[model samples]
Target: MSKIIALSGTKNGVISIRKINEPYGPGSGTVASVGISLSGESENPEWKVHIPLDNLDEVIKALSELK
Candidate 1:
């Protein structure tokens, strides 16, 4: 099983952020960064941003500007 951490929305509450931790083999893999977008229609598909674990800081900065 993988681990995920959710991020809060800004503004009134539109989008959310999620951090994915995927384990593969004996520490031979890495974790991924993903974003769950909820700003579209109720039936709209969620967007996934595949980012390397090393760019976690970038994700945080991007999420901070969301509303």
Candidate 2:
């Protein structure tokens, strides 16, 4: 599954969030993949980070504290 976030002040810019399995290959487990693209290319973003599923909650909490 995936979700997209449009960015303001930039044409076609977006952030994508997706769930990926074995992104690093078999036995790598799953991750919450977050990507940013200034060209609206969710499949090939300019920047990305993969957060292990187990760390999702703490990551969310930390991000929330930044808000």
Candidate 3:
């Protein structure tokens, strides 16, 4: 099975960061992804974001500033 590394667990949800090592196989592929996952409630839905490593800092900053 493919390996998945979980950096931390949170009450809100969890964040996963995977480091990609290539040549992964035949076709071209991504280098890495930073993800933010949220659990669904009765009215909401579960979702995950596959964020580019370069944009992670900006995204995190924006999220942190949310009120």
Candidate 4:
């Protein structure tokens, strides 16, 4: 699954979320990827982070707590 969102305060910026399978090659497993692109190019993000599926829940909880 994947999603794209317009970034606040920027005309052409965007944020993208996706599930990547074996992003680091075979055996790397799947990951939840979050990316940001100030240039509006979701395929080539200026910043990105990959969260392991095993840690997703905890990560979400932590992020929520910050809100």
Candidate 5:
């Protein structure tokens, strides 16, 4: 008799991108990356996206492409 094994694909996670106010206050001229937890699993995945605080348009474009 032969045994069959199941195959599965695992995902490391996804990088979540979102808008946020200026870190210092509410101005602009800065770029930052932060890790966001996506899954509700015990080991919350760590993800981040590079966004220009000055130009949100670029961020929007990148997000659109992702979709």
Candidate 6:
């Protein structure tokens, strides 16, 4: 797994994009995932979104289509 990017939020938090293992087993067909995670203080829960490596291209395209 590799990290694509890491950025600090203006308010208070850390955001990162990384390559991670697929949540399901390897047999699930997707071996890797490009995901986003946001981490904050102990009082706040973190959030994450993991896009399968295979679907990354489409996902990126769709998001980029937005303003």
Model 6 agreement with the true structure over 1-67: per-residue lDDT tens digits: 4443444553445454545454577765443333333543322326556677788888889989995
Using all chains and alpha carbons, the TM-scores for the candidates as numbered come to 0.34, 0.94, 0.36, 0.95, 0.31, 0.53
Candidate 2 colliding pairs: none
- Collision pairs in model 6: none
Which residue pairs clash within candidate 5?
none
Q: In the order shown, what is each candidate's alpha-carbon RMSD? A: 6.8, 0.8, 7.9, 0.7, 12.6, 4.5
lDDT of 5 by residue, 1-67 (tens): 1111221343443333334456456775455444444442312335455456656678768879998
- Give each model's whole-structure lDDT: 0.48, 0.96, 0.48, 0.98, 0.46, 0.53
Q: Mark the regions of model 1 whose C-alpha exceeds 4 Å error after superposition.
A: 1-29, 33-47
Candidate 4 per-residue lDDT, tens place, 1-67, comes to 9999999999999999999999999999799999999999999999999999999999999999999
- Pairwise lDDT winner, candidates 3 and 6: 6
lDDT of 2 by residue, 9-55 (tens): 89999999999999999999799999999999988999999999999
lDDT of 3: 0.48
Q: List the residue pairs that clash in candidate 3.
A: none
> What ordering of candidates by lDDT runs from best to worst?
4, 2, 6, 1, 3, 5
Q: Which RMSD does model 1 reach against the true structure?
A: 6.8
TM-score of 6: 0.53
Top of the candidates by lDDT = 4
Tens-digit lDDT string for candidate 3 (1-67): 1233333554455445555443246553544444455541312324433455566678879989995
- Global fold similarity of model 1 (TM-score): 0.34
**In terms of TM-score, which candidate is strongest?**
4
Candidate 3 RMSD computed on C-alpha atoms after optimal superposition onto the true structure: 7.9
Candidate 1 structure quality by residue, lDDT tens digits, 4-50: 33336633223333344554446543555344545532123266555
Candidate 4 residue-wise lDDT at 12: 99
